[model samples]
Target: MTAAVSSAALPALLGPHCTVDPDRLRRYEIPERGEPGKASGLVVPQTEAEVASLLATCSKNGVKLVISAGRTGLVEAQRPDGEVVLSLEKLDQPLSFATPDGEVFRFGERAAPAAHADALAAWWRGIGAPPCEDAVLEVQAGMAVDAVNLLLAPLNLMWPMEMGSSSAASVGGCIANASAGANAVCYGTAAHLAIQAFGYSGDGREVLSDAPAWKAVPEDLLAINSAQPRPEWGLIGTQGVLGVITRAKIRAYAIPGQREAALIPVSDMPAAMRIHAAARALFGDDVEEFEFIGKPALELVRDLKGDAFRSPLARHDAPYYLLLQVKSHKAHIDLAGMLYEFLADAVSLPEDQIGYAPLKALKEIRHSITEASNARMRALGGGRLSFDTATPVAVFGDYLKVLEAELKAEYPDMALIAFGHAGVGGAHLHILGSKDAPVARHAKALVKIVFDVTQDFGGTFSAEHGVGTKWGDEFIARAPAEVRAALIAAKRRHDPAGTLSPRSFALDRQLAG
Candidate 1:
């Protein structure tokens, strides 16, 4: 099929009800600042019939489709230029409270991601938490992370997925990428939290995915101190190539009766490692999040935000910062006391360097790093490449040291910024090059070095982010032939036309096969 469809013809085929203005189409064209590509025209389907009609028209006219929701993704998954772009913006509707299950929320795919948070909060006000055990919320694809949290907060419940872009990311986008942020160390990624996903396949076939993708890992097979694996959840992060996630049944956690955060300063990586080990011993199941902020990252925040950036530790000059959250369901349990005593007895954390801070305050400090890096890049007139990779927790320290050494030797002048969930092995490394350096050239080289090191350490190149076209080729090249073949077959089975996010997952070559 050739990409020859005219924008004007879209209204005739799909009807004016689904057609979008050129101004709106331009907005969807270029989503992120640095991301490549754009879109030609848009079709906003207010009803399921409209969606189906648009799909059928596109299929008949040989027009490709790219499913988009909060378009806040770093990878270019929504590049629909020269194709019929279907926007779910108008499908937003109120929560269906008359459902058979009180725990479930039937949502329209076009619901704004932020609305879920509002809905959950209102629901809690109307009726409290689930009678006995925790409950699940069925959210539509376009709901935002902040909105879900806002609604869930009053009920002493929350959808635990964390991302820097959570405020803007759609629930469907989160499920698509399986984003696991700072809290992923304890709560696991979006893949683990999503119990079921309902979506329309590329060829316009509706589908439900409730079963696990891979077998359960035996307890004996687990690494010495590694977190549990949910292989079945791997199906959640397909980058919207396989299908468009319309609705998802996700688990919500009870709000801890008690919550406290402590910022522990460490001399170096080795000392930081000790604090993580001690956290496991002292907090155990109560540990909610374990985040690390290297000196460089902290300095960036300090410089950008000025005195507004409050450091939990008095001496913000420490080599590394350990941000730990302790939570307890029992209101009577003294979490603060427990953490203090552990610090006193263990001697792993330096006595003078440890300090307590409000959870919200610490989170502000952690989130500011992203803003600082982006500000730096804007000022430097060059783009930055951030790599999210993970190695075994045991080798994470060594991996960090090696990564720093290699990056310094290769790009001596480049700024190195690091922070993320330390409990798990996931690390976020952002590097900004000189103003004169070619953005693409530096990005390519940095990606190669990082991915190579990640592979050598028996880690993954794309940790929480899905392998979009940006990383799709490298991901395919590294996969075993059998695994790659399996992926190809699955793509073909679900999207025979390969019309949705074509070239994603490296499935373009599978058409003839």
Candidate 2:
């Protein structure tokens, strides 16, 4: 039998919409982490007022709550254990647009000269009408990223950020994870794209909107929550433990007219770094996306994809390959020509060896690598362990060497599959461990090695992926005391009951009676 909610008053307050039936609640039990847990009940609120009321009622009734959105999180942040599962699914709504009045929202920092030129030209050809200046998109918490992009297409604007799971990722969940997409090198992360975040405090004390650099609280509270060097509004990445992110105002960018993609094979990381520098100099901000896939990863994709999958490096025996995309707002800018010219000077591959593919086709190869790896892992009856850690751009090559050396020494049989934004020094590595090995033991040992090495090099253990229930221990162990204290204080102020996603960020310690 499933555990029951602490408050019978919840059902009375939320009406028939709140469900305690086991059949309906069973589905909420398994979150993205695929953990075993039970939800006492499920609540799906439609309006911001309803959300605020639900949270207020939960606090008043002494009930725990876990916010669920898109259900795409990998860290088990939404795992519910005899708590009320608050689903944002019904909060989905059509996006609204408004011209910034200079207070509610503001235009993002002016793009560099290169990006400025690109944006202006794209704005001029605006679906037969002039683009509106200071246009901003107001998105609800539950709208999927792909749906949001579709809505913006009429204005020739897009969310700019590109993630592998955009098809199912929600705007709120992306902010909650501080997710970075493929184009993050130029477009930035969700935290940067979001200009305003509006949500109810977990304890229902306040219904507020936290915008960039806007601290509408007492100086004392700001000193506690915003004390850390990291931006405080980015608390959206805290997984709604502090509060439920109901809506966000995002800064949109114009879609580029001229876009081109190419695959280049390099002999080593040093060579890749040289190419990276050359591309930045040539394209400036026009270099929208740069992805790197080691030879091992490329081979894995090719093997799984079969005859239909062709490699861009068919003739080259290089150890690394880059999938690069260049987008320009100017119609006269020949992106393909630029790619060819850069190649002539940087790596100097023969003309016949050039593998010029369309932007969409090249992206397919990049995304397919992860898909193929997952398929292979399933076939072998073993799970894949992934690490998201980014080192300084200059020392990324050294970091890679250390990672490879440690992996080889410890687990020679495991396959090392890594692909990510090489320009930003973020590598998403998937290791396929032995099917016979114990999953718990392997995961613990491997995670320790990765975190320890990452810290030694001054790299973050959790990069784009936020630490959830799984990494709470690691976060507590590694985070500086002052930083942790600031976060806890913020949690206490926003979620006095420790009712929303309790135990996240080690906030559970404050909840002990």
Pairs in clash, predicted candidate 2: none
Looking at model 2, residue 422 earns an lDDT score of: 71
RMSD for all candidates, in order, please. Answer: 4.0, 7.1
Candidate 1 RMSD to the real structure:
4.0
**Candidate whose lDDT is highest:** 2
Lowest summed lDDT across 10 adjacent residues in model 1 is found at: 220-229
Q: Can you write out model 2's per-residue Cα lDDT over 236-263, one digit (the tens) per residue?
A: 6566777888888777678888888788
Question: Which runs of model 1 end up more than 4 angstroms from their true locations?
Answer: 1-4, 17-21, 33-36, 91-133, 211-235, 436-441, 509-513
Please list the C-alpha lDDT of all candidates, in the order they appear. Answer: 0.68, 0.71
* Superposed model 2: Cα runs more than 4 Å off: 1-10, 99-128, 132-134, 207-231, 315-317, 437-439, 510-513
Best by TM-score: 1
Q: What are the models' TM-scores?
A: 0.88, 0.87
Q: Rate residue 274 of model 2 by lDDT.
A: 72
